[model samples]
Target chain A: MRSDFVRREVATGLRRNVTMTVAMVLTTAISLALLGTGMLAVRTIDSTESLYADRLEIQVALTQDVSAADQDCSQPICSGLKKTLENSPLVESVTFESQQEAYTRFQQLFAGQSIADVARPQSLPATLRVKLADQQTGADAVRQAMNGQVGVRTIIDQRDVVGKLFDFLGGVRNVTFALALVQAVAALLLISNTVQVSAYTRRVEVGVMRLVGATRWYTQLPFLIEAVLTGVVGAVLAGVGLVVAKFAFIDDLLAGIAQNGVIPPITIYDVLETSIWLLPIGAAIAGVTGYVTLRLYVKV
Target chain B: MVAMATVATHEGSSLPLTLGDGRGGIRERSPRRAEGAGRTRVAGAAPGTVPTVIRLERVTKMYKTSTRPALDRVSVSVDKGEFVFLIGPSGSGKSTFLRLLLREDVPTRGRITVADLDVAKLPRRRVPRLRQRIGVVFQDFRLLPNRTVGGNVAFALEVIGKPQATIARVVPEVLELVGLEGKADRMPHELSGGEQQRVAIARAFVNRPLVLLADEPTGNLDPDTSQDIMLLLERINRTGTTVVMATHDHSIVDSMRRRVVELDLGQVVRDESRGVYGVGR
Candidate 1:
């Protein structure tokens, strides 16, 4: 027979067996819910990381104070360092600041402290500030560029903060996947047991088909189809539940946190997209799991 | 009475057969080997009558578990349009023989040729096409509980990819043939013991198979019901379908006056023309 004919027969069989059908749908829902949550968690980590990374800017702070002998040596030293850094290809820009200018900026930061008393303005060390091409350019490269250059003591990278944030998100994604794995296994076993019982109850019918020259695949197609259909139902239910939970709870929580600017916000569309894709994937998992589990007991 | 004719025969060798008169009397035929020539002739006909439909050459089947074989070196030839009964105790391999003919199980040794095809060597993919030519019935009446009586009957046609229009048309005709036309819409549970067996018969005959193989078909039915089912099978046999039924019912076998192939401990002990079920009636 054609595959269409087999598919139709399988559908008819699933429709007739109500208990098995419901079990399949429920199993599918649970598994997909776990998987969907995992996927959404990964997306959230990815989206938020990109947001933080995009906003990242390199800051080059200029140091102050220099001896007259050192100022003459450091000025050209600072100037030569700028050209070297700018020509090094990693540097996006080279800007210079005088010790008096640095002193004036420090006075603006702490209004009560006078520039002369904080440190003699004339005695302040003048230096060059270099901004890199991107936040990803590390401090090591800048350090290497300024190596052996007098008065160029240290270099700091701004993107290190973003890297730490990504490290934290990576850990969250791992937890999400681990949880999804457990839930998927549990759901697979439960649905398989459900289908096995269905097959056991209809053993007479199955045995009859076997005696009558029906192949193993012919007998199994119906149960697999039923499992998939049930999975679809479960996925739909889980999706609805996830949507309601996100809107009713998560959305308000994220909105509240948005005001403090502490944690990044999660959107409804993101959750919706995550939930929508889970249906087919959930159905496939349920169908495959049930079929495999039932296979050990039911054979031709 | 037409006499038996034997081919490739030796001295004192003879082949015995009973030809039906259509008026219900049995005609005995005996052939004797001719000298010098390797041909034997019946009293009424010349030599070389090639009437056999199923021929087995020392076929044997041994399952994995048991030490002894199921069927041991069985060699027999059945003619077209013959109604034969296969009788044996449990484990005597009557079912095995039938399965061999249906190509459901292969013989461990020797060869079996069914419907001019070397069934023992038939490829797996072509087995379904081979099965299409043979109708099979079982003791349990293996009907799908979810399907109606008519649906069960139509299933054979459906599996072979017959058109819906053809299934719809043929289902009713077969149901009518089995005298279960009025019970078409009824499910298996709704039918009585006899009616259910009739449904199974209708399903077997529905495909218009060349041979009908029924294994303990009426083993669960009452005497009267079993007789009715036997009559249905006999009626179908008259329409040119080679019928081979396996049963322990001696009364039914004796009353039918058909060829009987008897098995005991995996060996054929008797092959009688119009044979009776010898014991355990």
Candidate 2:
């Protein structure tokens, strides 16, 4: 292979079709960026799920009468209910929150909301917060054991609340992937068209080269290199875009949620990890598309 | 006519005929033929005869859309260091005959050989190697528009992976041989039609190929200029390169008094040694 000749040919081809090359690069970059974002979201969802699992617990609220009478879970009804929960095989540990403590937590949760002001110390119910050894099956076991028991009002699984957040994140991932897929199709079309046009413009010279005994691969390698060069540039731009989004967009937008620990933050490390694969992926897509297009549409 | 005679005289004096020792020089460059000469013998020929460079035995070509074949059972043989002109009117299969020799279009039936390699049996991967041994020229003088004359000629060697030093050396020599020594820096568009054709010839001859196939090389040139190009080709032929040119130019065939193979309706109607363009002309 003549590296110098190929280099010159690729440079000439890209320069000649500047508009098409730029369009292809930008389209590929956007699609790869969206793909990388979707992958990062998946990673975030996985981490957030494991984090919630470690802290997952089932909350059993006491009846108003039991809350007013117990004061400290010393009453037989409240104390016996707590003892039953702690003795269950599914329950890892059971902690009691008195009415006053429950009222304080309620105010903290609804802080800056009018509901926090409306809540009073006696109005809130005391609860037994039950931790489990295994989150998947322990919730059902605890619910069955505590159903219709004295002093129990309602049982709430924390997983149900977390499940809602996961569903929303999953929807976001789906949307990103859908958009990425559309952009990918556009990119493929643009790449093939660019290769065709490039080959067409240089058809005369390529014909002469072939007559002069150049192999088909020799005649076609310049166009393939042009596609791959654009793909690499697009991948680099996408990596830069991801890094910039992480710093300038995602970080500020998710700051409040990240601070509250509801979801994991999009870290620079994750962006780099996901962006790293985009280079090779971009090159492969462009290379293969260029090759098939040449074989099918352009004789060169 | 006076100008044509003067150009002919000038052509004779300008070229040195460096390799004019004839078949020995061309045969020395091709060792594969020497080794395989005994294995594949041309039929009806005496043993130990000089191997033919280009051969076609009952060759036929049929295009899918056309009712009749483009070339029909055409058989011809060209020996080493011979100049053969294919002459006929339009649709006489002149182009198809040249194309088949170049392997641009394969024969629907029959056998063809060039430089001892069977044209149809050669693998696609080795097609380039076959072409490298045979240089081709078109009437359009398909020079790279963007490249200067030197670059256009150099491109042929460059694509075939010839070293830069070799290209730097041979490009000037071939350019000089074709009488374009000082016009190397001029672009194709900047030169006249004759000069442009000369550049094309230089490119084809740069590799010193065993066979040179020219399709209407002077088709676009004036009568006076065409004579000059023809004389240049005649000079190159003296250097032991087998030249096969397809043309409709009668004056050239009649004036050169060379071997002529005339075709009509895809069949060889006349094969004459030292013949004119037409019978009794």
Candidate 3:
């Protein structure tokens, strides 16, 4: 029939079923909030790993010296060799270390310990520190290229720590996605059930409209609009809830981490970006649920 | 005025002439000429002013049931602007005959047309539109209980998607015609039986239908109220709406002295002009 009549009918339906409508909105909002929080958590893990990867460095350690014929060498010999290696194509920079320098670094690391009583300094190995283009490729290549160098015993790549950190973050991301999916499914069930009941309650009016030559679209349009409204409100609530949680828990935890110099802090921009995308996703979920449920249960 | 007078005529037999009231008399004259010579009227002579708007041609309705048809090869036609009565006992298919005009039940054998719309093979979607052209008053009044008298009347136009302004304008006029102007805001349950039927009549006539077919319209009313409804229907018929009333109310039919088509066992037993309810009455 007329658009004005359809609008009036929809308004009447909403007014008559106010309690159910609010319940539907609240359930949708809660479920979407859970989903948004999970998504933001995954995003935080990704950003943290990216920041860690960008700043982290790989350090290579050279073992005890050997002579060219017998591979034996002094700290002076290794230092001169380190300078020669620094000029190579693969190496970005190289710093030489003597036994005395190693002893001084150990004393700084364990400051209050009686190092003279517990240990002697004459047994330390002098080495060259090497920085490469990248930890995985350039540092590995450097270690391989230096395998047969004179007075070199072994090379140690420090990228093992970076590998372990990435593995942890990957596990976190997978768990986060799984939780998000569960929340989304729950939202779908709740919203679809609510819409189905709404259609059922209005079934007599639907029947009369059908008899009066109303097409299927006209009969279902109001419910579809209601579903859209629910979706929009739910999504906004979800995004807001995430913003609050991000500030309450995540920011405080990151702040504590930054004080200890363990890591830099996360930002609200990251959370906002992730949560904003959830709005459309929420609306889509509501629309699909409304369309499918009405198709199956209500006909014009 | 009809009086019983016996006189000798040219056929060497005595004929009876009953003369009585101006509204109640029997006049039968047999043609002296040959049959079928003047039976069919020539074209362009105003189409013989009978008050029947519906015509059925060898109509037969055979449902998916037993051996016999529901309406077996029935051929009857009604003229325009006439208050015709269809009288029958139970199982005589009086309801079926009423349904045929509304196209609720289509004939299986031949064509049936109402208001010049060939209703025999009319499409299903056009049924409601066709119904809008014919006002049907049911015995139950069939008023929506939730609606006011005015709302019920406006619903007839509303279903056909008439604009609100038109509905607002026409509903009050129809309600005034039905003498229910003061009861426009009252629900159906709040009105008396006569008033409720008037509301229904107003609903049916709001769009000025071509024919008014009432299936036992006064069945639920008292005798006085039934006469009032009949009077309303007669008034509507005076304005050129062909009115067909199906009823078993002997008193109402006997008093009207209108054209009566009497049916017995799904077949017309008598087709009499100005027929009475019973010979004794």
Candidate 4:
């Protein structure tokens, strides 16, 4: 068939069923946008993992009775504890955080909050942050050895905290995927309905083509192409939606908290990568849904 | 995806189908599978001469729900460039016979060949190529409602992948041939019943099909307008395209004095060359 004629037919068919076509496009766009968010959530989880993978800091807080009088460690027990950590092969390195250092860090970490103004140098306790060299087994050995040490207070396992972070990210991913699933179903149904209505309205035209010996493919080509075309348009719309969302919402939230370094910011690249991933998925979802529906539902 | 793509290639498949006899009995046959099997000449053909356009041998079609056969042991053939009329009552199997020709339905028993292709065996995908060689006219003209008369005619070529230049050149010639030259821009609803039928006939003949089938082409028109439509069909026939028209217009058949094949109760009761209508009466 002449390509111009096919284009004309596609345009005419789309125009003939404007309401259904619009609904199909909108549903496809929404579904793809949700899918993009899901993909980005997965990427964010990956980024968070890489950022914290080797940075699990094990903070050992000093008890008040052991060093309440002075920030300097002239006491034999404190110096002995420091030497024990230095001599241990499991500990990658140990850095002492003084009462003054902890207070300054706290003030900087909570600068925007009211509690930072009241915090003083003597109010915070000093501690050693242990970075395990052989993270797979060293952290367990150090925690076991340090559990009942003299002048020691409490051992804080950063790995457990990071595990909580991963759990939260995993929850976000699950929610995103669940919402995407619902939207995908909606998109598929809308696409099928659109094709069915288009086929029904053009029944006369299809019958004539069949009588004239046009192939089932030939008679059905315009509708299929229209379906694929609608899907691509929806994908582009979803890509745009992702970009706007990253700039208007995610970027703003990250900028506010990014200064304190509380959480690693998800870059625009994540949004772009999600959009890039969504284009083919969006097209595939629409195109495959259309083909299957035509095969099973529409006789032509 | 592979199956759908195979439809585009349209190579024959060895799909085993259930065969049945005329008396409402079913049987299985390990029928010939003609995939990559060279095109056998339409049954009973000598090469180089004008081929047999349509052939049906012992064909039977019995609807599953119906007690009696729709077409029982019916066999007929039309050579290239012949004009034949099918006459029958409402349930006398006229439409069923035409539908079989179109491969819209298959025969329960025996074989049907159109343009030398075993229509009963023709894969569903290749039906369009068979139909491209045949044109059909109906009682109610099936023109696309929005398109102008020229677009309706050009539509046949468009579906078959004809180029624009060819469509541009041929559409006007066909419109002129159908004597709707000036009304090329008019839509189907804008034209009268006869004019709409003319547009339909124009579309059918635009591709210059080897055979034309009309199912009550004049069923809706008045006598005088019906006479005009018949004249157009007769003119089409004179151009060496075989015409097979099914109609209950006894008066028109009588006036034409052409070959008439009459059907009664799913069987061909009368076939005469250059015979008038109701000659059996």
Say which candidate scores most in DockQ: 2
**lDDT: worst 10-residue window of model 1 chain A:** A64-73
lDDT of 3 by residue, B118-179 (tens): 88778866666567678878788878777899987876676567899999999998898878
- The CAPRI class of candidate 2 is medium
Where's the lowest-lDDT run of ten residues in candidate 3 chain B? B28-37
Give the chain B TM-score for each candidate. Answer: 0.83, 0.83, 0.81, 0.82
Candidate ranking under DockQ, highest first, comes to 2, 4, 1, 3
Task: Determine the C-alpha RMSD for candidate 3 after optimal superposition of all C-alphas.
Answer: 10.8
- Listed in order, the DockQ scores are 0.25, 0.59, 0.11, 0.56
Best of the two (2, 4) by DockQ: 2
Docking quality band of candidate 4, CAPRI definitions: medium
User: What clash pairs does model 4 have?
Assistant: A1-B161, A213-B128
lDDT of 4: 0.79
Where is model 4 more than 4 Å wrong at Cα? Answer: A60-91, A96-104, A107-128, A133-153, B1-50, B269-279
Q: For every candidate, give the share of true A-B contacts it also has.
A: 0.17, 0.71, 0.06, 0.85
- Candidate models: Cα lDDT each: 0.70, 0.84, 0.68, 0.79
lDDT of 3 at B152: 78
- Least accurate 10 contiguous residues by lDDT in model 4 chain B: B28-37
Report the number of backbone clashes for model 1: 9
